[model samples]
Target: MKTLLNVLLRLIETARILGLNYRDLKNAEDLLMHNEFGLCFDTIITQMYEYEIEIDDELYESISKIGDIMNLKPESYTFMKELIRDESNIPKPLKDELTRIITSLIE
Candidate 1:
């Protein structure tokens, strides 16, 4: 499995491909390096949503897998659930992963 930092870097690369400004994530690398997992994850997801970046299933699955390691907070869970619900274009696999996370939270 890819480490969280590697995932974040991949997101940055995606942002570059989309021509979106990725300064927030670039700055947040320090947080991840310092072991600030929650903030790093939150920032990546928040920026992705704000920029309206479309995540493919493979990348989304990687993010989902790392969520537990990040120790996501309550609001992070809510944010993810909302992301899954609101993004109509989300790929099925990505949606399924998000659904799994939200369902796990509910249980």
Candidate 2:
């Protein structure tokens, strides 16, 4: 389960880094279920933050407004903090990308 979740998380993050939008996420979700990831709709919000990818205000608002329709939940901000603290579990490519993204954001 953990490995599956990790892979889903990694794919979503990779898609985001490649500039995929929510629609892309939807497509990815279709593919994700086929894998052993065991991801539920509720997990997407948490996964978004886990990747340190930010959604704009309008997108965030939209996510909040229609989350139920999409079967997602409002993820707790603390999820990000916890995810960020667990670097040892992340893949090297993802870790490198995240570091690049964070560095660019800071600069």
Task: Report the C-alpha lDDT of model 2 over 43-89, residue by residue, as the tens digit.
Answer: 45455654455444444443444343334444533343332334337
Compared with the true structure, all predictions reach lDDT values of 0.63, 0.51
What's the lDDT of the predicted structure labeled candidate 2?
Answer: 0.51
lDDT of 1 by residue, 38-106 (tens): 676777777767755565555565666666656654555344443343345665546788999999999
Q: Least lDDT summed over 10 consecutive residues: which range in candidate 1?
A: 77-86
The per-prediction tally of clashing pairs is: 0, 0
Candidate 2 wrongly placed segments (more than 4 Å): 1-28, 31-40, 68-107
**What TM-score goes with each of the models?**
0.54, 0.33
Candidate 2 minimal-lDDT segment of 10 residues: 76-85
Candidate 1 stretches with Cα past 4 Å from truth are: 18-20, 71-107
* lDDT for predicted candidate 1 compared with the true structure: 0.63
